[model samples]
Target: MSSTAEEKTVMKVAEEEVINESRRNFLKSMAFLSAVFAFSGILGIVRALGPIQMKIPEWPRIKVANIKDLKEKEPIIFNYPLENTPNILVKLGKRVTNGVGPDEDIVAYSQICQHLGCMVRFMPAGSSSEFPDRNLFYCPCHAGFYDADDGAKILAGPPLYPLPPVKLEYDSSTGDIYAVGMGPPVIFGKGPPGSTEVWRDLVGGKLVGGG
Candidate 1:
């Protein structure tokens, strides 16, 4: 073969290799750019959909009544912490030594049902012929019944759980009955401490007449 032909052949092979290297570098660069853009888009989406923190304030305490207001075998409805939250305060007649009463104690419970978030009402023992002849917390929505002494139990209606109990304290000096805290707020029915605008409205007294 001629040296000129040999050189031309070598030059042609070297040119083809350079072109292939350029194509490979172009493809790699495009791939790197695409990956970077995709990663940035993912981060943006995550930032947009991040979990929101609820800012519930500490539970407030409110005076409901004086010790003299509650009577034996009677239940009174009142709002605690906030007026939107309903509560039931009961005064059990004198405590019974065995089964009779003469020195009973006072108790209070949140009226929100645990099963499906229904309001509970106090049903008098003899007022309703359909119900048993004992005082009980009754849920009219689903016929859920709870013991008056405690809250609702697992034995009633669609509500397989008991009602939430509020912490009640009586002021010795003033004889003022106050609710200090709540057991747990209803999840779906009521908004958490500071999660939504609804809570702010409640705090500002736009919904319940006054905050």
Candidate 2:
């Protein structure tokens, strides 16, 4: 082949190689940019969704009954913190620790049994031959018994914990009985029993603590 033809052919091959390299680099850069934009868009979407917030429950001060009308050892059924939650108010007729009322003998407790959420009934003193001295709160479903006097302690039964005690406040002039708060053994849920989870679950959402 002639020298000029050879030179022309070499120059043409070099130019073509450079053009191919340039095209490859341009494609690689575009692919990288596309990947970065897609990643950025995904991050923006996640940020827009925000973080998860858990809801905690709260209790409210509730009026339960009139002190003058409550009979000793007899319970008045009521709800506390929320509607449809069962509770019992009893007049013990004798002073006991952590008891509240005009005579410091009255007490209140949640009726929900700890064993399996069964309802507990009030049993007056001497009502049960097995437990003769003091009044008792009895759960029939699992034979759970709670002392009516001492914060409804787990007396003799399958209950691993005591009944949740309802804190009380009495109006001397108005004769009205108020449930101020709840004590331990709150009720099982996402949080520990009697923990904030109980209140949160009871209210069915995030609750700002209040009366």
Candidate 3:
């Protein structure tokens, strides 16, 4: 073959390789620019929407019963925070925690059972063979028992935790009994997102109010 023909062939191969390289680079740049534009559009949309406002649930002051209406060892059922949430108020007939009025015997607890989310009731002394000497709160389902005097401590059955106490406020002037807030354990199944809020409260080792 002629030297001129050989030179032409080599030049042609090099030119072809260069053209392919340029085409690949152009495609890569186009892809990178497209990703950058898409990202910018998403950011712009987010900025235009402004900051998101989350609505955190706050505890409400619910009227349960008047101070005169209560009797010793009797429990009054009422809803707190919402209409669906059940709680119980009991007149212990003596000073308990921050109990008010002349005797300071009033106390309250969440009716929702800690064991399996069952409704619990007040069991006065002698009502149950278990803890006959003391008053108690008893869950019929799975027999979750809590000591009524000691902040609803777990006494028996599958409940590993105490029942959440209901914070009460007594207006002596008006005779109004108000359900102020929740205490500890997070009230059974009701919790934020992953339902692990109770775990955090438990780890903190104190009675945390539902905020």
Among residues 3 or more apart in sequence or in different chains, the pairs in candidate 3 whose N, CA or C atoms overlap within 3 Å are: 94-105
Q: On a 0 to 100 scale, what is the lDDT of residue 69 in model 2?
A: 88
The better-scoring model by lDDT among 1 and 2 is: 2
For this target, which candidate reaches the highest lDDT against the unseen true structure? 2
lDDT (10s digit) by residue, model 1, range 9-68? 999999999999999999999999999999999999989999777675555667777886
Error of model 3, residue 100, in angstroms: 3.3
lDDT of 2 by residue, 123-180 (tens): 9888888788878999999888888877788888888888888888889899898887
Per-residue lDDT, model 2, residue 142, is 81
Which pairs clash inside model 2? 56-200, 57-199, 57-200, 60-211, 61-211
How do all models score by TM-score? 0.58, 0.67, 0.65
Error of 1 at 46 (Å): 10
> Candidate 3: what lDDT?
0.77
Model 1, residue 205: C-alpha shift (Å): 8.0
* Per-residue lDDT of candidate 3, residues 1-211 (tens digit): 8999999999999999999999999999999999999999999999999989654444567677898898899889887655566788888876766466668878888888887789999999888887987678999988888988778888888887788877888888898888877777677565652243543333322222342
